[model samples]
Structure formats: C-alpha cells, structure tokens
Target: MENYNVDTVLKDIFDSKDSNNWKPSDKIPLVTKEIETLKNDLKTFLKSSDYNMDAILKESQELCDETNLLVSGMEMCKQEIEEETMAEILHSIENHDRLTKELESVNFALNIVYDVVQCGKYVKEFDDGREAQSFTRAVEAVYDLLQYIEMPAEGFKQLDMYNNTRHTAQLILDSLLSDLYGEWDRLISTSVKPGNKKTTITITLNIEDSLIVIDVLNALEKSKKLVEKVMEFSQFLLKDVLVPIINNDCIVFAETDELMTITVNQKPDFKPAYDAVIANLRLLFHYLSNKLNVEYYRDNSIMKMMGKQICAEFSDILVKDCLIDTIPNNINELQSYGQITSEIEDFQHFLVIVKFFPDDKISILKYVNNIDILFASKSSQYFLETARTIMLKDLSVTMSIGVETIPEGNPGTSADVSGTEEEALKILNKTMPRSLFYFPRCMISKTAQELLDLVYVMMEQAVQCSDVVCKKLYNTTRLVFELYDAVVPYHHENYLQTIPQYVALFHNNCMYLAHNLQTFGDKWLILMEGRELDYPISFVDLVQKLRDLGYRHLAIHMQQQRKQILDNIRSSDLNCIVVKDVLSDNAEAAVRQCLRQLHLLKNVWIGVFPINVFTRLMATLVNMFVDELIHRVCTVEDISMEMATQLTDMYTLVVQKAPLLFQNTTDVEQYVKSWKKLQELIFVLGGSLKDIEKHWKDGTGPLAVHFNTEELRSLIKALFQNTQFRANLLSKIK
Candidate 1:
C-alpha cells in the first residue's frame, strides 16, 4: 500500500532539512496526520483487488545485483595495490646488481695497487747499489703502473686486468733480484784482490744480517742431498789446487820472518772475508749436525788437515836444507838402529841384553835415555820395556853387540846363555826361576821370595816325562819323588800308574845334560850351578836306576800292588803299629810305599777279602784315592749315609782350604765326599735330635727304650759293620 524507496526517502529528508528548520512542531503534527492517513490508505489498498506481485519481485532482484557489483569493485582495488608492490621490488633488484658490480671493481683495483707496491719495494732492494739513473727509471715505471691500477673502473672485467698486471710485475721483480744476486757474487769473487777478497765479498753479500743469515742457513739445510757435491768441490780446491800451490818451491814468496816483520809494521787489518767464509762453513756444519744428530766441530777436521800440511811443510824444509847444503852429510851418518822384529824370542833376547848392560854404557845412549825419560815421565813401564826389548834385540844382531863371558873359576855365572852350542835344558830344579828370567828384577824383587817358593813347589810337583831328551834334562829319581809327593797320599796307588811317562822324560833330560856337560870341566860345573841341579848323572844311568827300582812296571800293575799291601795290612798280626815304620821314613814316601804294597795285596787276596775290606777299599780310595774304585762308588745307585757324610765333609774342607790342590779327579772326588758327609751328618743329627725331643723330657738319663745302652751298642755295631762305614775308615789309612 505504501512501498517506500529508502534513498529517495533519505534524499527527501536531507533536502527537506532546510525546509524543516522552518518549524519542527508544525512538521511533527502534519507528518503524524499524513502517516495515519497513509496507514488507512494501505489497509484499504491491501483489502482491494490484487496488486501486481511480479513487478515487486522484479525490483528486489535488481537491488541484489547492485550489491554483488559493489563487492567485485573492492576485490579489483586490492589486486591493483599488490601489482604496485611487485613493480617496486623489480626496481630494487636492478639497483642491487649495479652496486655489486661497482664494489667488485673497487676491490680489484685496490688489490692491484697493494701487489704493485710490494713488487716495487723488492725491485728497489735488488737495485740498491746500481746506477741512480737506471734505478730511478725503474722506480718511475713502477709508480706509473701503480697509478694505472688505481684509476677508476666500472666493473670486475676492467679490475681483473689490473690484478693480473700487478702479479706479473711481482714475478719480474723476483727474477731481476735473483739475477742481480748471481752477478754480484760472480763479480766479488773475481774482481777483488786476494788480500782484500774477504772484506769486499763480505760487504757485498751482507750475510751477517739476521734475515740473510737465516736464508743462507735454511738453504744449507735444504741442500743436505748435495753433501757429496760440496765435498767433491772442497777436495778439488784444497787437494788439487791450493795444496800443490802452497807446496811448490818455485812459487815461494818473501821469507816468513821478513813478511811477518813487515806485516807487524802495518796496523792489523780485520779479515771480514775470512770470517764470512768461516761463518758459512760453520753454518753448513751446524745444519748437518742438527739434521744428523751428531757432534760437529770445525777445528777438528781442519786441524787434522793442518797437521798433515805441517808435516809436508817440515819435509819440504828438510829437503830445501839438503838442496842448499845447509846441513853436513855427516849429520845423516849417526848410528842407525835396525828395524825391530816382531818375533817374541827376538824381543826377549833384547830385554836380556838391556837388563845386563849398564844404562850409562849403552852405545846409542840417546835411545836409552829416551826410554828412561819415558819410564820416569809417562809411567809406561810395560810399553817402554817392550820398545827397549825390540831395540836391544835389533842392535844385538845387527850391530854385533858383544856379551861378556864369565871368567874361568869365577863363582858367579851370566844368566844369558846366548851363542852357546849347548842346547838349553829346562831344568826341573826348584831353585830355577819359574817365570821368564827377563821379567824386570825391580818389579819382581818385592815378591821374589814368594815366586821362588812357587817355582820350588812346581819343580817338586813335576811328574817325569817319558821322553829321553826330557829325562836327560831333569833327574828321573827326583821327578819320581816329586810325583809321589804331589799325589794324594792314600790315592797314590791310583795316580802312580798314570805318571811314569812324565817322570821318565824329566829324568832323561837331566841325564842328557849331565853327560853332555861332563867334558866342559868347570864350565859344566858353572852350568850345573846355574841350573841349581842337586846331583849330576847320565840319562842312561838314571833310566837303569828307575828300571831296577820297579818303576818300569809300576804303572802296569799298580792296582794289583795296592790290593796286596791292603791285604797284608789287614792280615798283619802287629796291632797299633806306627804307619810310618810299616811303610817308609818320610810321610810322603810311606804313602808311595803303602800304595805299592796295597796294589800287591789286592792281587794276592783277590776274592777272600771281606765285604768290610772291599767297602773300606772303596772308601779309602774314594776319600784319598780316586780312580776306577772311587768312580764306581760315586756312580753306584745306592750310596750309604756314611759314605755321603764323608764325601760332604771332604768337599767342604777342600773347597775352603786348598781348592787349587783339589783340581784332579781323585782330589775332586775327595772334596765331593767331604761335602756329602757334612750334609748327611747335619740331616741325621737333626733327625736324631727331633726324635730325642719327642721321646724324652727336658732332662732325663735315657729318652726312650731305643736309646738305652744295649740298644745303642747294637746300633753302633751295625753302623761300624756297615760296608760304607768300613770303607770310609779304611780310606783314611794309606
């Protein structure tokens, strides 16, 4: 009935504002009356015939289309704002690209300038002592290049050229410095005078500077593989060139004294070049020592060379003296001691002569004096003795040095037996010296008596030799006596069988010497006196005496003889008799006598011998007699306690008191017996004591029934009756 258009109504309301301002109360009454009238009219219109609804729906659809159009316009405005932002980003990217290219160009130009400055400094160092004009030109060229590098550039392409140019300039400067150094070395080495060479060269190189010194040292260290090359150059210069030039007589300069005087007149000039060369060599050695971990000294090798050079110089001086007739020919005619022979005998003979002659009377007194001086100053008696021996022997044969002979009927005889036709005999007399006679008398004098006693002991202990020659030199009876005395007392029977040959030879030598010297009259007497021989007899007579005495068959039937003597003693009715009377006058002689008797007894008694006798035989021989019997007992599977104890004690005694004397098999067996005896005694005694403790109170008459008198008697009888016990007891006899 009253379809209102809001925009038309709002426009009507705004347009009527000026009119409504005319009267608000009048407008309100008129509007209210018109609304009531419009309401009545709408109700009347609705109640009337149907109005057109299709036309109204068409107008509503047109209003919805207008709202959709307005929303589309707002979306289009947002898209236009985003497109403007994208345009601004594109413009910023182009600006960044332009700034990047400019920065790269600036960096490149700066790098070029830096490199050019470094290269120019190096070039200036290289050309430091060159012509000013040339140096100035080179410096200006470098400056111009630097300027060019500093010129403004647009991009990296232009700047890259500046960097390349700068690097090329550095390369050129390095090459120029290297060439200049080479030329400078060559010029200094060649152009300087010999006397001024060191100073000029040192100033030119300035190798003393820290940087320069380090470089040189580093180069030397790196050149280790070139050692052989350096050595070869040194050898060529010193040996091939310098040595020969210095040695040349034709190239002699002013006399040394004159040159030294003139040089002294002038102020001393410092040798910088010489010092540089020395420093260079020192650096080289230092590098080698560090690399190799060795001790290096410059003076050591140089001094060795200098020594050889000095020797050569001295030889040259002598040669020059000879050429100039500065020394007389007679000066060379002084007595020449001949070359020394290395033979020991030659040396020994020389010592004998030196010992016999008076020191002051020596013909070549200077050589003798040198020896005395050496002995006094150096305390090299051994070496001096050796040298003196050599010299004396050489002079003796070569110079025909005479040896004085003992006067006829003189009591004293010369020890030197040189030039005598009589063959020297090794007399087995206790009085003769055991050591080499030429041993310095002064040194031996302090111990002479002891040495003499040892010699006596050796002589007395010498077993006779089987040789005829030896028997003639040494008395056979004396040798046999010595063999008997040296043999273990009770075991003499065992050793007697083995020693006849040595005895026989000793006798043969003694006899031969006696027979040969008989015709020499007092000279033979003197020789005998020197040998200290007790009695002189022929070798044949001595052999005959030995044969008559049964010594010829002693070795063959010694065991049989010893057994016979044992049987005789065991069966003898005489009880408690002195063993000495039963055997011989002397103790040692009695032993030999008893041994022979026992060997005979063994053969006679054979199987009739008691077990105790056999055991005693073994023990006796085992204790004092070591031969097959002792060996058999030692190796036997079951050794009795008694035998073991005896062996232990014997061993202990021998080891402590006289070890050297017990070196023989028989003696060693005795010593072992002593040791075994001591050990067994300790064990048995300890066991017995332990048993006694178990059975007895602290103090008691008898510990137990087993320790009673009757029981002890029985045990004692059993022990004494034991084969080992009997043997051990019997062993102590002969």
Candidate 2:
C-alpha cells in the first residue's frame, strides 16, 4: 500500500478557511458532512469496473479511511462552512482516483506499441505469415492511440511493468512498405525500352537504382526499427521477384514444379543472364545493407534465393547427370569419353563462376554437387574401370598358366595306372592375345586417356605416390597414354582417311617398323628415343614422373623372337660333361655348348645392356674356350701334330666369330699362346728332353719358344711314361 498524505490534502483544501464563504466556527460541520458523503461515493464508484480494480479498490478503501480521519472528530469539533460545498469537494477527489487507473491503461498502450516494433526488429523475415500480420495490426492499433494521447513519459515512470519498453522512432514502419516498394519499383523502371519498342523485362534492379535506394536508406537508418522491418520485408519482396526468375528463366533446368517445356536439348545459356543477375544483386544488396545497416539480412536473404531457389533446384534437374552415369560405362569409345568430359568441365566451370559473389563473404554455394570430390574420387574410379575393360577386351590380356613342378624325389610315374591328379602330368602352356600381331602396328589404338591423366595429376596432390588408389589411377592413366600413342600415327595423317588401303598399309608399315627395331638394334632405339612427343605431354611423357613408367615399347613383342640356335645350345649344356676339357670324349661338345650359350647371352644383351658389358662377356667366353682346349692338349698322353692342328683350328674359328677380340697384336699373341704351347710340347717329345730342358732354361730351344725349363721338364717327364703318347712321339719323331 502506498502512503497517502491526507493531511496535506486537507490543509490545501482548508487554506480557503479565510475565504468569504463562511466563518471558521461553521467550517467544522461542513467538513464533517463532506467526509460522510465522500465515504458513500467510494462504495458506489468501486462497483463500476473490474479491470485494474486492485489499484482502484485500494485507493477507494484508503480514501474511505481518510474520510473517517477528517470528519470523525465532528462531535468534538465546531462547524464553519456549508455542508453541500464540502461534499462536492470530496466527490471531486473520487474522480482523480479513477483518472489514475486510466493513466495505467495508457502506459499499457505504450508497452503494446514497443512490442510490435520489436517483432519487426528482431528477425530477418516473418517466416510465419499469420504472426507477421498479427504484429502489423498491433502496430496500427498503437498508431491510432498515438493520435489522441501522446504517450507521456510520466505515465510510464511510475510503472515497473513498462519501464524497459522502447518506443522506436520508426513507429509504424510496417505501414511504409507500399510506398517504399513503389519508390524502389519506380527507380527500377520495370519496362526498360532498349529501342523504340518497350521490351518485356524480368530483372528490375540496377546499380542506378541503388542510388535512389541509397537516399531512402539514409532516411531509414535514422529509424533502425524501420530498417530492420524493411530488411525482413525485402526478403518476401526479393523472393517474389528472384524465385520467379529461376522458375521461369534459368540457364540450367531448375525444377520449380511449373508446367513448362524443359528438356535436355533446351539447356539454358546461363552466362549472359547470370552476369546481369550477379551484377544487379551485388549492387542492390550492398546498397541495401549499407543504407539500412543490416548486412546479415542482405546476405542471408540473397543466399537463400540463390541456393534454395536457383542452384540446388536446377542441379537436381540437370540432364547431364544421366551422361555422368554413362561416362564410366563407355570408356572405350574415345569420342564419347571426350564429349562427356568436355561437358562436365563446362558445367563445373559455370558453377565456379556462379558461386562467386563479390559482395557476400560467405559463398551461396551450399546447394552445389561438390564436383571437386566427385571428380577426384568417383570419376577417377569410373575411368579406371573403363580403361581396365578396354585392356581386357581389346588388348586380349588374361591369366597365364605357370610352370608346374613335382617334388625332387618323385618317380617318373611311367608305371602309374590310375589317372588321379597326383599321377597326372604337370602341363605347360602359354596364354597370349590372338592378335599379338598387334605389336608391329605400334600405334593402332587411340583412347581418351588424357582425362585419366588429369585425374591422376589432380589426385596425386591429395595423396601420396605410394597410395594404392593413386597408384592404380596412375597405371590406368599410363595405359591410356600407351593406347593413345599406339594409334598416334593416324592422328598426323588425317588425309589417309580418303585412301582406300590406308588402314591395311598403315598396319603393315607398323609391323615392318617394329621388326626393324627388334633386329637392327641401336639405330632404331636411338631413332625411337625422345621421339614420343615434341612437347610437354607425349604418349610416353612421365605421368607418374618415375622412369620407364608408361607404355612398354612396341618392340616389347621382340622378347618372343626366335632363339632356336641358342636354345639348342643351352639344352646341349644339360646333356654334356667333359673330363679334362678338350682331351675328354665330350670336350668339343662342351666347348661348342659353352661358346654358343655365351654368344647367345652376349648378343641378347647387346640390344639392352651397355656395350662394355657385352664386350666383357664376349672376352670371357673366348678366353675360357681357348684355355680349356690348350689345357686338355698339354695333359693328353698322346700329344702330337694332329692335336696341335685341331687346337689351332678351334682358336681360328673363335677369332673369326669375334675379330675385335684379336684386333691388337698383343691380343693376337695371347690368342696363339695355346697353339704355341701345344707345338712346343709335341717338339719336346720329338726331340731330347734333356736338351729341350737345357734350351728352355737358356731360352734357346724349340720348347723354350713357349715355356720355361721347369714347365718343359714337367711336360716331358709326364708324357714319357704313357705308352700311347710314346708311340705318337716316335711317329712324329720319324
């Protein structure tokens, strides 16, 4: 309960005691009768209304108590004034109490007004239509009340309930939409006349109009509740304007659920239209944000319009998605892969351009397909599948049967009667493409392998070189490069298409070229080296950046070339084992086997290995062959002229095969050492061993020409005991 100053009220009212109405003696009864009337009036007035009756009832009860205080002393006090006049004065106090309750109602009115303003200020848009209209009506009600009783600050000061309420300067901004929109549309000028005739136009906003919006913005910012209200309302207006553009006219198909003709063939030409849209939006939203000071509203509203209204809706409807599905399936068709890849690149490029909004810090690209991830992972996998399919179908690659071996101790199994797999023969077979005739025609296949190459390059950045998926993608790319290179000859000879026998001739020529490359060696290797491409990308260009990574040389088929002579020689080594080398029964066989194997191994390496290594293998084989023949002859029991002739013949045959080995005098001398040693051995047996030994020691005898005294004595003493050697010695001596 509030403390009431009834004494002050009575003192002020009684200050008129000296007025020319009545004596001081008569005033007492007048006050007594008036207080009794005031008490009766309170009981009557309290029954009028129930709203805010707590304060009204409290005031009435307090006034009744005050009446008792003022006139209760009537019997003890004297009367001075008229009873009727004092009763009128007390009745007037009842009216003042009622007026205070009405003032509380006025404060409640201001609270309602501030609330409607807050509704417009708080959010970007009234997403709920019913709520938006309810707030609008509430603001109008406040505006109407503002006409009669301007909200006095004094009414709100006493009330704790209405203390924090803010009456915005933009009191009825919700009411200003029609006129502001008119100004916007007028500035935009809906039907722009390019020439004499007015054209039907869709895009209404322009940079020039942003200036008009600028002035309007300056005025609106002065009333931020109005700016916030406009920021929210502008969205509905923007959607009404922009969403229709996407639904009606779009570069790509955006499904707006409209009954219109949209087909794959009718794909939108988006660049020019998007250029205009972006330019207009950039300027329009920026000016709105600056003028109204609601950047969040401007950016959010436009992003929603672009993404939900335009990009996302259109992406779902694009006919290109169907093409993306088939690209993996049609990897073998070069033209189809090329076309599909070209189209996808264009699509992604367009999205990149569209998503770029200079005015917006956050991209409005949420609705996109995220083609980066798609191309990196899925598209790459699809391309690999395509390449593998091509390799399987066109190249004729398949699993091959390996050599099967039984345990070392197993019997020959010739006695086995049953046909169980344990007794079954381990078979040997080869698997090869039917048309490995494909080799000589080095370049008969072409592929759209560059797409896979691009994918490899892109993914390599995201992964390591050793990563399995990356390695597989790289191999696929490399094979595609191989296929492209294989048929690259036709690329340079486009006019050959008119020639009737061009394909046949070209294939025959490739075969001829490959055969020459295999047989002739370094001339072809040198010619083919660094000839893959003249620029950055070649069929053999290092995709993995590792050496020897891509297409095997067309001459790889040459690995299968005939080696019948060398094979027979190798087979010969398994059949022969010589005793004392050339003197043994199988010495010639061993010598021939060893020399032929060495020749085959050396000649084979000439095409692949460095020249020094080939020379070394040749030298080793020659030296070993000569040494073996000489050693057996020197140790033979019947050392004679015939043995010397045979040993010399073998050395000459070897020199003939490889003339470079004996090109120098010293090398030729080294070559003859075995022949010379045989001759001196036969001479020592023909002559006296004692004299040969003495001459050998002095370096002056027939044996001394080749051997020292110790070697001569050793040879002569060994041969002297064998009867067959002594007989050949006697015959040679005769």
Candidate 3:
C-alpha cells in the first residue's frame, strides 16, 4: 500500500547536478530510463502478487462511514443530556451562592471570638505569672496580650469590645512595667563609705536574679530604664571605688597597720598602685559584663555609658593627679614614665575591648601621649644646663691618643706588659713591643664626647616619643647642639690663638662633632619612615654650620700664620736685597723663620691629624710661603743674575724643605696649586729671555697655564729689558 512515484524518484536520483561536471539536462535520458524500469517492476509485482486491491479500498470506505455515523450519534446524545440537566445545575449554583454568604458571616464572628479568647487567656496567664514572680513569662504574656488588643482585625476595630480590651491591656502593661521596675530596684544597691584616706564601696546585687530583671525590662520595652540604672550603678562604682583607689597612695586594698615595718632601702614607687588600680578597673568591667550580664541589657551598649563615665573619671585622675606626679626627673625616670604611659595606653585599649569605650573618645592617656612636651621642655633645660656645666667645668683639652688593637691573626702582633704577673711583688718587667698603637682620630675633646653622649641620649628619647612630642624633642636636640655650636669657639678663643695643641684639638673636635652630626637627622628619621612629615627635620644645615665653625677657627689661625710670614717677608725688603750678599740676607732669614714656624706646626700636627688632612694643611702653609716669596720677587724692577741667584737659592731651599712636610705622602706639588707656577716664575726671572720663551712654549706650556698673561707681562717688565722679543712674547701670551 506504500506506493512510490517512480518517475519523480528516478528524476530526483538521476537529477543530481554535480557542480563539478554534470548538469540536470545531461542526466535526463538516464532518469527517463530508470523511471520506466521502476514502473514496469511495480506493475509486474502487482500482477503476480494479489487481486483484492479494490475490495480492500471498499472495506476502508465502509469503516470511515461507520466512524462518521458513531460520531454523529454521540453528538445527538450529548445535546439531549445537556437539555435534561441544565435546570438542576442552575438551581445548585443558586444554593451555593446563598450558603457561601452565611459561611463568611459565621467565620468572621468566630475569628472575633477566638481572638478575644486568646487575649483573655494571655491576660490570665500574665496575672498568674506575675503572681508567681515569673517575670520573663509574665512580661511575654503582657507583650502578647498588648500586641493582640492594640492591633485587632480590621472588622473587629469598630466593636466596643475591642476598644475596652485595648484599654484593659494598656492597664496590664503599665502594671507589668511597674512590677519590672520594682524588681530591678530590689535587685541592686550601692553604698559609698568615705574614709580618712580612702573610700569603700558596698555594692549589693543579685547577679543571677538581675539577669531575669534585665530580660523582663527588655521584654516590656523598658530597656532604656535598664541602661539608665546600669549607668547609675557604674557611676557609683566609679565614684566610690575607682577614684578612691587611684587617689590613695596605698596599693593594697586592706588598711596597713602603722606598726608594719617598712624596708628602708625600698623607694616609694607608684607602679604598684597603678597596677592595682588597673586590675580593679578590669575586675569591675568583668563584674558588670560577664557576671551581671549587663551586655545583654541594651544590646551590648549598656557598658558604653559606663565606659564614658570611666573615661572621664580616669582621664581626670591621670591628667590632674597621676601624670603630675610622673614628671620625669631624668632620662631613666623619663623612660620609666614612658613605660607607665605605654601601660596606660594598653589599659585604654582594654577599656575599648571590654567596657565598649570608643577608641577616639579615650582620653585616659591623652596627657601621657603628649607628656613628652613637658618632658622635652625639662630635657631641653637639663641638656642646656648639663652641657654648660660640662663645657665650663673642663675647659682644658685632655688629649687621648687614638688607638686600635692589632688583629690577632697578624704576624708580630703582641702585647706589652710593663707590670709582671707577680706585680704583687712590685716587679717591673717590660716587653719589647705593644700591639696597641696610637693613630690619628680627628680627636674630640672630653667635653665634646660628653656632649655627644648626651645628644645620643636625647636622640633615643626623641625616637621613643610620640610624633607631637618628638617634634618638641627635636628642638631640644637643636638647642643642645646650638649651645655647643655657640659656646665651644667662644670658650677657647684665647687658647685657640696661642696654643697649637688647642687649635689642633679644637679642629678635631669640630670635625668630630660635625661628623657625628652628619647622621644625627638619620637616627631621628626612623620616626618618619612609615609616616610623612610636612616639614621634616634635618641636621644637614646644622652640620654645615658646625663645619663652617671649625673652618672659621682654622682660617683664623691660618690667617694669623699668613700675616706673620708676610710681615716677616715685607720687613726683610726682598725687592731691595743686595745682589751678591747671599749668606745672611733678610730674605733668607725670613725664609728660614717661615720654615721653622712651619716645622713647629708640623710637629704639633703629626700623629694628630690623618695623613691627607696633614698634607693638606702643610701644603697650604707652604703655598702661603711660596706665594709671598713670588709676590716679593715679582715686584722687583730689574733682577740681575746675582739677585736671580739669591732668589733661586731661596726658592730652592723652600722647595727642598717644603716637600719634607708631605714626606711619606704623594708630593707637595699635588696639594699646592701655585707651587709649580712659582718655580716657573723663578726660572723665567733668572733665565735669559729665551728660557722664558721656551718655558712659555708659545702659550701652551706650564708657564702659560699657571700664570695669566698680565702676570707674565708684569714679571717680564720687572725682570727683562723692553726688547721686541719680550713684546712679541707678551703679545703671543694673549
């Protein structure tokens, strides 16, 4: 019965148009042949298989006709049933509508009765619970009854019974509130007993029963009253216990008998009393929060009020009494006070944790935090005074030889023992050598070292202080150094001039002070590491000031030495010296005196200053000497060969002796800038005009490098005749 259209099937199969090669028209003949073959096969199969095709079709038609007849008959039956039941259905709907209205009315009246009965039950339960002193349960019943009658159903609102019920519930709530208050009043009491030296608190409270009272008060919506009552109790405790403990000097709670022996060596310390006060305050907090369960009284906020009161009272005690006594007298005492302040801060943190004190509102350690202000003022005065005392007491310089022990592994390093192991027998045994040896230290004075030690102490205190107080302490640091800065030079003005040892020691002291002060700000910078400062303190400027102070004093001495040598040279009249008299010329004596003075300074400076600094100072002296000689010779109008010979001899003597000042170091020429130029000028003055031109090297030589054109011109005019060669050299020097 499932027939296929062979022509269409064959057309679809053979009509495959391959986009690569074949088109629909090209496969038409094959499609026609296949359709014919399929049709023939279908006909042959039908003819060979059966002959009942028409009869089957007729049977299917008959079944369709029978289904149609059944469907039509059922429709007729449905219409007949609907006609028969329509009137009864309408009547049932009418009865349902009428009963639903009556049901709604009855349910409404029943809900009202039920609600009223529930109210009455709760009221009765409240009355019974109140009688039984079950305040939690009684309060719960009153709360429920009040809620029920206060907000009745919308339909019941207009009824007189509901209005009366609301009134009765209000009265019941008032009575419940009154009973809760009465119970609370009976649960706790406080009595303060003031004594001669202390005050005692007598607190009576039912810890277990107070919890019940708190719960009843909370349930009755009277928690504010509970908070108020708790605050009142805390105030009494603060007044009677906290204040008295902090005020009394005795640490122990029990009164001590006068007959109790005191330790004579023991000093009176407030720490024990402070510890006891803190411990008692902690116990008070525990008693309120953990024992009485006051945290639950107002959602953990009941203690905040108490905390505020404690904050006020404790803060007052610290500021007005305790901190006033804690004024530190010295650094060690200040350190102790710092520790106490730290403990006070920790106590404040504890209050924040347990008593619900606000961190920002904590003022108990306010004065403690800023107490460094007072301490800084006192410290500044103390440092200034102590520095003045130290500076004034020992104005004399006590020179300490700077030494370091040779490392043990080094060869030939040994110790010198003057006294024998049997020194008890007064034996004097001496060793050949000593491992400990002296070296240069830009040596600081004893007073300077003491001042530095004081600065170190102040620095530590500043580092330990709070930022606000640290700033003030920095001023103290500045004041201490400023005092030294002003006082050191003024104190030793006379010695600095006459005493070479004093000058050297003073120079070393200034160098040491400046060197130590170089990192002075760095130590204080530890405070600003994690914090930003608007105006950061630095010792850079102060360090420069100290250096300048040292240089200023050194310059004063150098200028004095300079004036002495220059005066000696001026008085010798080298410009008018005899050409042939070379044995004992005034210039030679001046030169000798200059060298002698330099040698004396060298002796004082050796082993006192580091080699480089020694070389620098000696070279400076040599330069001054050579420069004055050059100035004298350059002023001479005509230098005969004999005068040049005398000047050359003086120059050679200076050169030979000046180098001995830097004996082991590099050379005098390396440190002294004008040394080579002075030699070149002396050569040019003594040599013929050719020697001058050759040394000049057509303006590209050492002569041209050291002496300016005007200097060489002046020298040429003073020493040489006005020849064209000199004029041309002068013109080329430009």
Which candidate tops lDDT? Answer: 3
At residue 30, give the lDDT of candidate 3: 73
The TM-scores, one per candidate, come to: 0.20, 0.25, 0.42
- Report the lDDT of model 3 for residue 588: 85
| lDDT for model 2 | 0.40
Q: lDDT for model 1, please.
A: 0.35
Summing lDDT over every window of 10 consecutive residues in candidate 3, give the lowest-scoring window: 257-266
Per-residue accuracy of model 3 over 1-734 as CA lDDT, tens digit each:
25767577866765565646877687778778876887898788888886877798999999999999999999998898799878788999999999999999999989888887888899889888777777766777877877777766657877887878788778877876787667766666556555554444554555453556556556544323566676777776666555655555433221121111111112234343566567656655555554353544445445566666566766787556555555673557776666777777787787677755776876676665556667766666776788788766453555564443434442332355344534532222134233222234445568878878887877777666666656776777787778877776778778888777677777777777777776678777875577656567778778777778778888888888888877777777574553433334677888888889888888887766666677888888888888878777666555565666777888888877887777563478798877897878767856887888888898888888988888788778766778899788778777
Tens-place lDDT per residue, model 2, 37-146, is 77776676666646677887899999999989878677335353354567787889999999999998887877766644544444223223225534343334334434
Clashes of 3: 0
Per-residue lDDT of candidate 1, residues 553-625 (tens digit): 4334445544644444334311112221231223223334444543444443222222232334434433443
Query: lDDT score, residue 335, model 2?
Result: 31
Tell me how far candidate 2 lies from the true structure as C-alpha RMSD in angstroms. 29.5
* Clashing residue pairs for model 3: none
What is the lDDT, from 0 to 100, of the residue 180 in candidate 3?
69
Full-model lDDT for every candidate:
0.35, 0.40, 0.68
lDDT of 3: 0.68
Error of 3 at 605 (Å): 2.7
Q: Which segments of model 2 are wrong by more than 4 Å?
A: 1-299, 302-585, 594-620, 632-667, 670-697, 700-710, 722-734
